[model samples]
Target: MNPSRPAPLTRVDGSPVRVLVVDDEANLSDLLRMALQNEGWDARTAANGQEALNLVREFAPDLVVLDIMMPGIDGMEVLRRLRSTGNDVPVLFLTAKDAVEDRIAGISAGGDDYLTKPFNLEEVVVRLRGMARRHVAAAAAAETRLRVGDLTLDEETYEVVRGGIPIKLTAKEFDLLRYLMQNQRRVLSRSQILDQVWSYDFGGTSSVVEIYISYLRKKIDSLGEALIHTVRGVGYTIKSAE
Candidate 1:
């Protein structure tokens, strides 16, 4: 990773965020990988949920772009298992099912966000990046007195703590956490976050959002309570877990 490269606003390592794309559609996975990589993320792919889980343990991705309708070990089941293992990695569900119930079910099942099929790749990238940013911020803020839920963020020394346990975060992670806490509980659009936190015009990709959200999940949700929620057909919000 280039030291000069602008680290993800939400990662502690200041390195390119890592992502796992889980879909049975080879073509879709390839396209997503290319798009994510274009944004400087370490993007990888899996053909199914089981394969995705294997990669998750190995790659330890910051976020997962999961297809809800895979052939085996569908996205919902995969999420269930991940939660069962106490893995709070942020997940953005991609599905052909746009029914309101389906969307609700996804959120109720612990998904950080959801995207419908026939979606624009750029939008997907944007939303994902938004997620990643919030997560990174939460993780980085774990140090000092800043607290989101039971998680605490310390701006003075750049530390993080959750449930009274100390958590370490990178510089970028601290910045991201501060941003979210500064605007806690607000529904922030991807474009808005990119403009404010990224400090540059995204020019078309949204994968950065996903990457950071994944980072946050690793830090915050790893303990079980999901503070971030996706508003289908809209954007993301950081709130006290309901």
Candidate 2:
């Protein structure tokens, strides 16, 4: 498998995760598409709020990357409509406006996270991964099982299965696996994982995330079917062999 594109993320029942990117800037949209694709996520793009809403109904994405400013409906209004419809898919707001009020407004409008413009792509990917992880953790209680293609994670027993075989993971490995499984197809920076999973502020080094990722790769991807990919100059993602 190519190192650039990993495998797709699947539910416990084996359904792929879908993502929607809404931005007026074509270049930014393309960048997001590339980043998400590297993670094996099925991502679609919309140039404006109206187009975003249209795709929301059709694609039913697992997550949304929404830009606040737009020609017509705007991100806040679109989020309102989504919430009105009871579609609680996580949304990460991307906008040029970086004010406390703006952040509050975005969150108040049902945004799961807020990212300012001119931000690092790694940061965006990391925040999105966190949102996805939280969403999956919530659903894990009900599902009791989580699987992506041939790999399976049992929430009840904390067991992992690959190609119908059992795999052992250390405590940290298990936590990392759970985080990766939750985020699945979204790129996660080493610093971001350290912050979320480690529950501490990360210093200026990525050695920890890299080391654990290496450990995970040995156990999860040593069999030729690569599930973890490194995005050069960015971060890593847990995706299926693509």
Candidate 3:
């Protein structure tokens, strides 16, 4: 374990994150299991595809660190079976197959991310942490609507309302406002907003960000208690007064 590597999360909820490491190599499986346990997770190991599937049913892990090549029922097949049954558990593939096509195949077959063999332990830990974070965030984002005090944004209908009044916004303004609301209370710099709202190739300046932010404020904050706030010289943050 590298000293400078980021630490794994303590847990998502009250219980530690559960991980199932599936690989035919006992040494590799053992190493990963020990490492994950050290990171304060409930880590289990599966020697082959059959064992991996069994654990998938029994352990119901939060993450599956799987291998591609195995003697029987291979990693890809196991993943396919899991997906076929509507299991969307996050999986990180550990494989020697580093080619682009192999990666595509793994991803197309439902792997979340892949790490080539001879991987750095720190890299594995970082990827696992990132995957965990994304899994948690995505689950939260699947909500149909978001509310902050009197303001409400419906994801399915693309509607915004404040204090029982409907608010209309342009497509760009809606996107920007949605981003801000999703990450409510987190100050987002102009560059970050541009990248997310306008995408990476918008070729716009910071002034554009300022203009749209003002537009959102007028629509969203004009009627009700202000939710959009500017952190002078830093960026913008949105939080409900309630």
Candidate 4:
């Protein structure tokens, strides 16, 4: 018995980053599978559109390399169906047709990228890596929720909870709090806060900065140790009371 081949390399989230090569050409798929395996990535092949769909469902691919010229449920339709279902998994299309319209149609249909036929294997690999990196970055950024100890803020929902209790804030306050949490331990000057949260030049008195900071402290720090603090002459900072 021979030793089983090791699994592909994983993305930052620990699960393997799977790539699907969808092409009717067995030789090309075979070459890609071997090349991707050498890159420490999991790779699979599909001979047609229907099989590609089935594999996408089962494989939950991190990226897909699709052939535009496949017979039957062609690559364009495959992309349409995928997008219709709101599956935004990144796809790179391979096309022998160099028509500008075809590339435009593929992109407008939802393809993330495309490679003209006879593309260098190295270029294919580079494009795939670029696509995969983008997906990972988007996934990481989709983390709408930020937390520190008992305090939590949801960027998408504009909600805040601390110590298992919901806290309400005005829009300005929420924006200010979000900025503070984003910066964490970094002290921020009034001018800095005014520029970022207020998004304008106040021109003179920074009393607005002081007022909002006080408001945040009252609402956020009243029930617990201070999470927001004045840094004397420097500015202000947020950290756990401990």
Candidate 5:
């Protein structure tokens, strides 16, 4: 019998991993994009730091390949702004300088990893996979109590409450809610929800995500201004009602 293939790495919401490749060199960015796409990941390229910053919001990449030396904003300043704004997306720095100080500065500026120039593309892919895995694992492990507005979920006690009213949920429902709460305002594709909350081995389809989302809405949204929301043509998100 053949061994089953491993599940692909994904965002907490189960979407294809997104990567932003930022470098002044167009050729290098193009090459990186091709490599990432070959790995079944989405990749976007930015010519400079400013463009990189813009794409971060528009693309919402899970990881960033930032060039430390840029004409304007530079990688360090870019990393600083991202960190300051509470954006903890993992970053890998690319630098032409091989000095110890250069590597240290990149790390000090909040880069998760750094690669010197003329590095191997294969190595880049390996490091990025590692970072993506670590980041996802860290996000899953770091939170116990997730809150959005007045709604809260306690991972330890498996309790869910909204506006001080306790809500009961089945085990699957609880897992679904926890995944959504963990992702907060981020739109979670049905496929993402299915993969993370219910395994393919569980003999379920993406429709199960929709059904449970409906269940969650009836139980939780019915109590308040509706934290559970549907993003048309995309998926769902749990956000504070405006």
Candidate 6:
């Protein structure tokens, strides 16, 4: 890794960040994919707007490099549809058009950034790094304080509360609960939990996930409507109590 290069941003689940490159130009899309992978992101490519939309749903990319002009369903319409569906994934528009009006139109269509064709590769990486920084900052501000039903967890202060009552937890237990709350309502397998919450040096097996979960349940679920649930043969999920 280059010492000066910004560290790769990770998904909320602590997995590698995913990026989608959309373009009709196969060579350009391939180049961008290779560059992003070099940055340690999981990158995919789509050759048209429709394919891009399909991949957005299936891959759930953290960012998209979208081309403005395509044969069917142009990038503008794709972005419009995405925003309509409340998918606010950051979009960087690529266009051969360099007119002032064209740039304005792309930005107005909810593009987070714009780049013209024949741009420098390093410049693209720098712009993406800037966008990634802003995205992480915004998410950090929002997720520093998390809430689900009457339960709350503060990442910065390491606090957990339920129904207006403060709940005490050990460091490991707090980490487990924070991970669960971060992915509220999403079923998380034991392996996933182990990867995110435990260090590589941890000598325990997958059973440790269950042990920490049980500790959290005694502190959190025992107090109220049971925010944590076990999905038979799958794993666990946490959600707002109904």
lDDT of 1 by residue, 94-124 (tens): 9999999999999999999999998999999
Q: Each candidate: what lDDT?
A: 0.83, 0.84, 0.88, 0.88, 0.90, 0.89
Where is model 3 more than 4 Å wrong at Cα?
Answer: 1-12, 140-242
Q: Using lDDT as the measure, what is the rank order of every candidate, best first?
A: 5, 6, 3, 4, 2, 1
TM-score attained by model 6 = 0.65
lDDT of candidate 2 over 2-96, digit per residue (tens): 76854555544566557799999999999998897776677899999989999999998888999999988999999999999999999999999
lDDT by residue for model 4 (1-242), tens: 23585444467677667899999999998898888877778899999999999999999899999998989999989988998999999999999988999899889888999899988999998888778878877777766887766899999989899898899999999999999888889999987899998878556665988999999989999878789989999888888854
Residue-level lDDT of model 6, residues 128-190, one tens digit each, is 877876776677687798888999999989988898899999998988888898899999988
| Winning model by TM-score | 5
**Tens-place lDDT digits, model 5, residues 1-242:** 23583566877767789999999999999999999987778899999989999999899889999998999999999999999999999999999999999899889888899999999999999999999899888766656678999988999889998889999999999999999988889999887887898875768553788789899999998987988889999999999955
Between 2 and 4, whose lDDT is larger? 4
> What TM-score, computed on C-alpha atoms, does each candidate reach?
0.58, 0.56, 0.55, 0.59, 0.66, 0.65
Which candidate would rank higher by TM-score, 2 or 5?
Answer: 5
Worst 10-residue stretch by lDDT in candidate 4?
1-10
Q: What is the lDDT of residue 81 in candidate 2?
A: 95
Which residue ranges in model 5 land beyond 4 Å of their true spot?
Answer: 1-7, 142-146, 159-239
Full-model lDDT, candidate 4: 0.88
lDDT of 5: 0.90
Say which prediction, candidate 5 or candidate 6, comes out ahead on lDDT: 5
RMSD of 5: 8.5
Least lDDT summed over 10 consecutive residues: which range in candidate 5? Answer: 1-10
lDDT of 4 at 118: 86
| Candidate 6 lDDT score at position 94 | 92
Q: Note the clash tally of each candidate.
A: 28, 4, 0, 0, 2, 0
